[model samples]
Target: MGLEPDNMSGSSPEDIVNAVFGHFDPKNPLTFKDEQFNSDPILSEKALCLVYILGADTIQFTDDRLIEKLQTVRQRISEKEIPQVIVMTKVDEACSLVRNDLRKIYSSKKIKDKMQECSDLVGVPLSYIYPVKNYHEEIDTKNDIDVLVLRALTHIVKIANDKLLRSDFNKEQPLTYKDQHYSCDPELSDQSFCLVYVIDANIVQYTDDRLIDKLKILCQRKGKTDP
Candidate 1:
């Protein structure tokens, strides 16, 4: 999501934060979409993960108000179990060691300190923060820069997959089968599921009772075999 210019001044931190996360709140629903107001409902529900792009060189000069808003956003996303990552760009401009030798990113104390500062400010873990050089002057893509970006993307996809697997409308309710209820399994993660039943649309209403019973039996067997 893009933030309006500071001169616009009409959008408050609370407004922006609410527009993003409030859609998931059943108590207070945003019923309308306003481009001028920068409001889009159901943003949180549609987004698989949140990615915060920060300039590594100017992180120290980040505005206090923006930081506070981000902290609140982080808290809400954490409560919902959505993954958030920070891509700290312009790493070369942030540290001289990394600028001279891209391989020294890990060993560069300055880069590490900047990453830690970002984590402390945004409430995001250090592991989820990636420092990389944004392609500004380079006419060609560099392997070192691509590596850092790819690593962050890989982590984001993995965590997002975990969230998707755990997501279900009935997750809060107990698993029930034929009046039998079972507690939701908390250990479920990285699981895959695919169960499809297709019948001719024209004949769907005329499906035999015996066929329906067979389908139910198949569903029960599939559930039993699922890990």
Candidate 2:
């Protein structure tokens, strides 16, 4: 899902908080209910990744307040282990060398400077920052422009896909017992497992109820034998 605020430059702390957490105060960090994000139709769930789109030429001109707000949002999202990337647009407009020859994008000192500035300002790593030219004025698509956009998209998709698969595995494979009482149903279909590890003499007494419960879940998802 995508969410675009009406005025990013003038966005207040409440606006940013509301956009991310669905309301002013979230009960849990990065946890959301189906009805929580009803304020914005686009925000149905917690974001898998955050993408900040900025103009390459206007990075220096960005308001200080907006930068601070973005930093705050980035910190909150990072706490949940969500990935973030910056897409620096209008690279051709920012650098004369890149404007003349798109191949010079990587070699241009000005473009590199702008990207570094954006990285430093937004607190995102330079590697996650992608510089590209928007297809605004051009009537036809260019190969170089396409290459830059495709590379950025490839990385973004890989990260998002990794997170999605991880979340699915975590939800479905673990924590089968939900209620206060724990019970196993033999009639239920069994899940496949590949490995099992037995407790050692020294560790047997050290395993408590909580630890055993965790081990039981792991064994159920990862072993062929019953714990």
Candidate 3:
């Protein structure tokens, strides 16, 4: 139900909640945890909506082919599962880099169009994309991290409450939703974020722009690239 820096060694419930303190604790070494799923197999099998988040400190958004890479990330998410949210945190940095560039590239219509393109290619709905604020770069501090933890916890509680509500009903089968092969009977939580695309006023550059351009061209040649 919560997200934080983890040591990778399993721990008790309290350990999970306080794990953030351990990693972000100034006294501890620079710590990082791979995205993981809780080992409750019963819960594991249930397809929980994924929260895809991009972070700061680890994010490097600047320069060439960034949009192309973003497209690729969108592709990955669409391929994986319907995303609960696609958080683009450290947005201040993104904005700072290219004052108006980010907006220009990420217009509402443009985004929808792009997502639709990705969905068509990946064969999924474009409705699942969501965004949130979860970074601290300009007004740098750990508050952003705190916000991320709280948001994750909120999502977890919602899932738990759903289970509680279903238990009260005593139904043979619990209430759930489906996305392709995904079944939300068991709750699952997934987190993700963006990295390395530089944006400046009126200009957005991709770190891997050249490569994506070439690839985009290839896709275009094959009659893709409508978004």
lDDT of 3 by residue, 6-36 (tens): 4342232333222322223324333345234
Two-way TM-score contest, 1 vs 3, winner: 1
Measured with C-alpha atoms, the lDDT of residue 138 in candidate 1 is 87
When 1 and 3 are scored with lDDT, the better candidate is 1
> Compared with the true structure, what per-residue lDDT tens digits does model 2 show for residues 141-164?
899999999999999988877776
Model 1 Cα lDDT, one tens digit per residue, 1-227:
34433525544444444544544343443344533332443434455678888888988988786776677677876776778889899999998889888989999999999999899988889988988888888898899989988888888898778766666636467457543344444346634477788889999999999999989998998989877
lDDT of each: 0.74, 0.74, 0.40
TM-score of 2: 0.61
TM-score of each: 0.63, 0.61, 0.27
Better of 2 and 3 by lDDT: 2
Candidate 1 error regions (>4 Å) = 1-45, 169-227
- What does the lDDT read for residue 136 in candidate 2? 87
Give candidate 3's whole-model lDDT: 0.40
**Model 3: residues with Cα > 4 Å off, grouped in runs:** 1-40, 43-47, 52-107, 121-124, 133-136, 140-227
Clash pairs for candidate 1 = none
